[model samples]
Target: MNPEEIGLEKPGRAYFAPDDLNDPALTRLIFRLGLPAVAGLSINAVHHTINMVFVGMIGAHEIAAITVVLPILMMIGAIGEGLGVGVATAIGRALGSNSPQRANVTASTFMVLAVPMGIALTAGILVFRRELLGLFGASEAIMPLAEHYLIIVAFSVTLTMLQILSDFIAISEGNTRFSMWTLLGCFALNIILDPIMIFGFGFGLAGAAMATILSQIAAIAAYALYFRKRIGTLHLSARFAAFRADILKPVLSIGLPTTLTSMLSSISFAVLFTYAGFYRGDAGIAGVGIALRVLTLGMLPVIGLSLGGQAVLSFAWGAGKTPRLLAASNLLLLLTSAFCVAYGLGAVLLRYPIAAIFTDDLEIARIAALTIVVTHIPFIFFGMRQILVVLLQAQGRARLAATISIAQNGYFLLPLLFVLPHFLGFEGLLASLFLAPALTALLSAVILFTTLRQLRGDTDLPIATFTNTVSERAS
Candidate 1:
């Protein structure tokens, strides 16, 4: 059906129905899907960096406070991302299986789950704000600021969750441009409001949170309107109200592992912050926090590329195009690796200048520069791991994706951080970050190769059109 036929008002935009996957120009098709997704994710990374930059003007204490609370926010948001990934992958697969009705059910059920989750997260953060800050090893100086930031952020949890749901739905439906526009609008608002609220209004740390929350609310509103008017039939009627186990199972199954992986990363960050606080004090923690924000900026495009690849891979798999799925994964790995290598080199070369941009203090700059240099040594592997995990998740291999997720951040990274630091000190702490992703990538590559071999016997799956078309034309 045409987009218009499906109640989508946008007449000119391209739609990614299941049949679109059969297009012979596989690389072009994948690029179309992945590019806008990458752009949206990159914008998100920029938003975080901008927030940190503006907030850093206040002082190290302010920066440290934000660092303490930001991960907690990410952990909560991971719930939505994890669930969204599951929903998107399932929806794509259902569409591939020629089951539009099933896709609709999955989308609705995911929203239902998100509502309760948002409420629980909001309430939990409000009640346990102090405890959470304390666990992050916040200094007495930073505790009050952290509490202020957390309160505002906690209240915005529902809007953030809904925005994520909308983004996922749009991407899964092949409306990547819509997601991009939504993020662009929100990010623009955030950039404008950040300085105004933080400096002009003199809200300090709370102002930063307010800026973020307001942007999220705006995004949620935009997405809600777009979904209702432009996208397919999504209603709150009784027909859409009922939940299905079959739809819930795959979404949760894929989403839970990714969610757990994000949770582990958040925990790891907390542990690292605690260790930094004990050994280096507030300035050290703040420096590390600043470095992470920089890292977030550097890693943005890679993540965008990874997410874009994921959407393409998922769509291809859902369309039953196994060969295209495989090709897309390999192409993504190669492209991301090249970008990572270039980024790592540039980061090392511009270390001093980059650090200077974030802070004026020499010591903080030195620590941040060192952290950036060390953490990025395994950058290529990290990129590979990201692409592979997405590939596995899209293909319905959540267990493998989850394992890679844990290995990258949790299982290997955390222990290494504590152990290596005891012997080598700060350098060891830095080395652990590099080694974790490198090792995880190696392991993930092996697992992915093995999984593909096993799937060779599944002859019922459709071969990618690119390979098939080339073969047919030759004959």
Candidate 2:
């Protein structure tokens, strides 16, 4: 069948081939798919950094308050992200299996589940705002500011969840351009409004929160409209209310690991910050905060690339196109590793300038600069680990994915933090943070190679059958 006959148009003169891993035309196709997914994810990291840039101007206290609250927000948002990843992967697989009804069911189920959970999360945050902030090591001085920020953000949880779900839907349907536009537009709006609300209206920390919520609301609207018109067939059905265990099982399987991975990082940061506070006081926490924000700015785009790899590899796996899947995985590793190496070197070299943009205080900037140089040097392997995890999840190997998740967060990071500080002191703590992720990357590589070898032996599966199933389901 012609590409047009299957609802896919050739980008150029070359005809489409499912197994064309080495085709120049196919490489371009993968690039086209990967770039927008990268952009979509990067927009999220951009919003966080931009928010930090504005909040940093207010003072260290404001920065600390935001920092303390960030993990909680991420923990809460992890629920949505975890679920969204599951939905995206499942939808892609269903599309590959030529089960359009099942794909729609997956999409609809995500929406139904996300809304009530978001509402409950919002209410929980509002009711326990003070208590939650206290657990994160918030001081009396920072408590009020954190409370203000948390309340505003909590109320907008539904909008954020909706936007995330919509983005997943777009990516699953291979309409990443639409997802990218939604994120970019929201990011631009957030940037434009942050100054006005924070400085012009003197909203302080609350202003930043307001800007974030408003931007998310706009994104939600845009995504909703776009998905209804141009993306997948995600019509709501009464069956979604029935709560099919079979449908939700895969989502939860994938989502739980993803959530734990994020939560573990949040826990690690919280512990690290608390330790820094005990040993170094507010200055140390503020310094670490600045360093983290800088690191995020550098690492987020690589994460974007890894996410792109996840989407492509997951779809390819679902389609049983082992060659294409391997190609996509290797391409991501090569490209992202190169990017990380350059970024790590540049961060070390230009540490001062990057730190200075956040604050004028020479002491904080110096500490931040030093920390950035130390922490990011090991991130060269971080992207590879992330890509492998995504690949495993796409293939529905939840056990392996969960094990890697635990290894990265629980097994490696938590233990390192406890043990390293005993002998090395503060330096040990810092070293542990870097070492954990680097080790996680190495372990992930081993697992990926082993898994690929096993898949190679499974000779009964036919790639064309898989591809046809996906195409039929997607349509």
Candidate 3:
């Protein structure tokens, strides 16, 4: 079939058909896939920021309590996030290669597995709860609140993984709208419930946790409803749940690097929080944590673009459509890089105002503002590296992706975390955040260049000839 003969959306179509991935206008296709992913993520980040704001009102130490608990939460969420990425890549490639049964089985198998993994994690975490709290820099004063928050939050793990898998599977098969609504609905419910549970019912930290799980429950309900409708390409069912080494291996290989990267971030943040607590006490820890949250919120858009772009890239790769892959890579880089530069400048301009939203304490706000300046601004350049990592994953080049993933935090940030603090005190802790991404971006540039060169040679032609290769694999 030619590009014109491929599946495209009809007026009454509920979602884009799998093969429709190749024929949509590049800009429309990328954004149609990307925008909702970013919107949900950005709003969710807003929820966290606002949660910090609500928590801030209780006391600075409560903020400190949250600061300490976040890394632990991230560590848990990373499992779902990482696994979801793996599932998405696998399914997207499978569909592009015209294997719907593989797509169906992959979703069913992973969803079945996610529940047990989440349950085991919750059990393990609760068993080791206090130790983890202390390990992440929860001081004696913050420990009770952190523990209080975490105990309630832990039970949501199974549901969390379920929701993530459902959302990613939906996204992979060209059904991002429902996934977006799931996230947005969860965000709405959590926000509405946060104040009610925290202040109205006087649950405090426990209230926030209650609100979170309730929102997650609602999200899972929504996903279940959507999946039952069977509007999209894949139908997830227990009938398809049998394990196959073939599916699990590629999924793990593609996914674990991302999990490690997120975990490394959690570890680095834990280490940073410890330093902040040592140098600046409760206020510093809260301030630094707040800044980091802001940094993540800011990166959401571009990160969303990169991930969304990855689906497109992976589809093209599996179809052996050289020009579509190159077009995707080019457009993604252009859009993400532009947004990052613009957002970084906005970070510089609004640092104080942004930080002030999370806390009333002048010292914490000032510290957060300074951190935004030091951390958020330079972190813009990471957009380049972020896109590169996702691009590599899209191409199913796990080794290269894993190497880039490690370079981000493991090689650059983790080493710098200890070395810099030993030399320059608190300032150095912040400096590590700034420098690692910069260095990683430099390294990723070399890799990106080399990867592109290899792609050109592998395609058996130069960049100019890729455009003619679109129908090369439509068998």
For candidate 1, what is the lDDT?
0.78
Off by over 4 Å in 1: 1-21, 232-239, 452-475
- Give all TM-scores, in the order shown: 0.91, 0.89, 0.93
RMSD to the true structure for each prediction, in A, is 4.6, 4.7, 4.1
Instruction: Write one digit per residue (lDDT tens) for candidate 1, span 208-282.
Output: 999998999899888777756544333322256446576678888999897898898888888888877777788
User: Where is model 3 poorest over a 10-residue stretch in terms of lDDT?
Assistant: 10-19
- C-alpha lDDT of residue 440 in model 1: 83
List of clashing residue pairs for candidate 2: 95-470, 96-469, 96-470, 97-469, 98-469, 98-473, 99-473
- As for TM-score, the candidate ahead, 1 or 2, is 1
Superior by lDDT: candidate 1 or candidate 3:
3
- Residue 48 in model 1: shift from native, Å? 1.0
Q: How far is candidate 1 from the true structure (C-alpha RMSD, Å)?
A: 4.6
Query: Which segments of model 2 are wrong by more than 4 Å?
Result: 1-24, 233-242, 458-475
State the TM-score for model 3: 0.93
Candidate 3, after superposition: displacement of residue 26 in Å? 1.8
